[model samples]
Target: MNKRGKVVRDTNAGTGLISIDGQQFPFELEGMWKSDVAPCVNMVVEVDFGADGRVASVQVVPESQLAREQAEAAMRATKDKGAALGKEMVARFGAGTLAGMAALVCGWFVFNTITVQIAAGYSSGLSFWKVLGVLNSPLGFMNALGGAGGGSGAYGLFAVLALCGPLLPFFVRNPLAHLANLLPLLFIAAVCAIGYFGLMDGLKQAQGAALAFGGRQAAAMAAEMASGMMKEALRAVSFGLGAYLSVLASLYFAGRGAIKYLSSRA
Candidate 1:
């Protein structure tokens, strides 16, 4: 039987008890309740009965509609918040300035590196390690131009450069904490670059010796390659400080714009 009822006892059931024609039936609520609005006690509801006359489907009527409206209102509020955030972002970065800069930097690296790798008969695929290598050292830039390097080095280099970028300003403002920030990137790159180069050099030497025993010139070639790799590692350590400085400059400019906008608005 199809009937309409009002919820009597809530009692924490998936469906609540309802009074229908002066009779109480255990009824289950269908679907989900909306956040911020819920079915009220004694709210009118519709129910379908099973063969045994038990409630098959129970739905709160007017209260459910109220819940739906509340949910939509909440969604609208969230959209407004998102719009405000967008406006704040635009004010801080000057509406595409940061985006354009990012595109330029990434594009320059990709275009240069991809072209060289393609010409060298390497597959036209990007390598994270290679990118890191470039970031860590001048050798990393060289790798993009057909030198040997990887992502670990590139990440290290970027880190080092970023750390050094804000040193002078920070030192002038707060010597102790600012100074601590300045050379961390370089130090990190140094440790990583040293470890990587050392491990690779040892491996190459071992391979070269094995090949030379078979009358190949592998050992001599590997030894020569090791010197160049070692040189790149050293260069990476030296240039880390410069890269850190550039990153700090970028962040400082971005932050300055944000502060100016906020002060003006205030």
Candidate 2:
């Protein structure tokens, strides 16, 4: 029989003891040693036993080979565990989560929700993720913080919350996941609110300047012109197909969560 274990005593040129499954066996270097890897104390080896129950031959296990085997074993265990966990999540959450995830991913990849028009005559569209990127940038960050650093940080905060929507579904059993999915709608509303207020502020400023310098006639004309321009701007920035899909995904999650929560309560 061949057994694998480590050497408890070094036998570089003479006899020493090795442990194989709690049994120590005596080995000699003259004939028993059979590998290029030097037999040192604590080195793992395969021990071939003789009919007399003594160590017949000992071959050292290479460190590289041992490490490779250990790594492969760990990888296999992780793969199996991950597969089991995925199956469990699928079973627990059913297709609701999968569908929601698919829709949410599609929404993230589709048409942008915000449009930026430059005086240079070109315009750009931005999705929620891109908006988050802009918010995180130095220039955008400074602009978001405003002149006195007193601007509402709620936009970035809500955006961060909205980004977490997809991750919440992984909880499998948490009812709070419904709230996470709904964050997208809130974020969308927030963006729209910001745009609306910005347009209104611009309208107010134009009217105020016209009234102060150009009299009632100018103020009335400015108000009329600004109102039309505001409507055009709103059309330019109206919610894209992506926003609609994201809303649908949020609604799905909400409906699923409500049913699940009620069922659990009953």
Candidate 3:
């Protein structure tokens, strides 16, 4: 029987190796080639095995056959990957493709959905993936979240943790890994608090600057206007569905982790 392989190299005048099914087999270019010249590197060839299961002869396969074989190989590879992925999912979830389902849900509601709609704010309506990218840049976060700069960007750090820290538990061993259950909740809390405080801090600075320029005489009016300013500020920032959905995801992670942990203990 004959097999197909790509020529790996023409090492010398009459000797070389070819890769077949990912294994390299040496072939003699002497009388076995059947061609005037030995096959060039990267050329596909048909191989005949000897009684000892060694390479007997090799010749270039037809172009049509090469193309058909390549397509078939690609299809086989894709099927193999899909089968492997399905098996892994079943091993982990004990059922269907739970991971794929979660990813699809998250991709729609969390990754692609609008995070917030900011009428004038920088952080408005951007997808979750972009928000994650900008969270690392202090000025970027401030600009995106408020269209203003100067916040310590502590929320951005928490946001990073909220987005990425959950994966740690899956990779680490138990006990410590168990923290994944509660960590998401903590991260979400910390991010909310820090984000709110950062905004308030910026607002206060603006108010103080107003008082500084207006002098003590304007303090009365500043105090009078403070309540309205706070109201307007709160009204300007409306949370979008994606933001809420993201929190729900984090909550789900925590709840599921807790269930698994408790079940293990039981």
* Candidates by lDDT, descending order: 2, 3, 1
* Model 3 C-alpha lDDT per residue in residues 1-266, reported as the tens digit of each score: 79978998885765699899989999887767866555788888889988898988888877798789799999999999999998875776545225433542464235533444355544455444444444445457546445342333555455555555455555676755655656656765755575577667766776787789897667557765776777875666555665566567667667766776776677
- Candidate 1 ranges with C-alpha deviation above 4 Å: 1-61, 101-207, 215-266
Top candidate when judged by TM-score against the true structure: 2
lDDT of 1 by residue, 1-266 (tens): 77777878763656667788899987543443322335557877777777986667666667667789789999999999999997886776455444534433443233322222233344333232344565455445555445455555445565446434433332344323333333433443554586577667676767667576844576666666766866764443322222334344445444554454455456
Cα RMSD for candidates in order? 13.1, 6.5, 7.7
Q: What shift in Å separates residue 95 of candidate 1 from its native position after superposition? A: 1.4
Show model 3 residue runs off by greater than 4 Å.
Answer: 1-65, 93-124, 129-138, 141-176, 220-236, 262-266
Clash counts per candidate, in order, are: 22, 0, 3
Higher TM-score: candidate 1 or 2? 2
Q: Which wins on TM-score, candidate 1 or candidate 3?
A: 3
Ranking by TM-score: 2, 3, 1
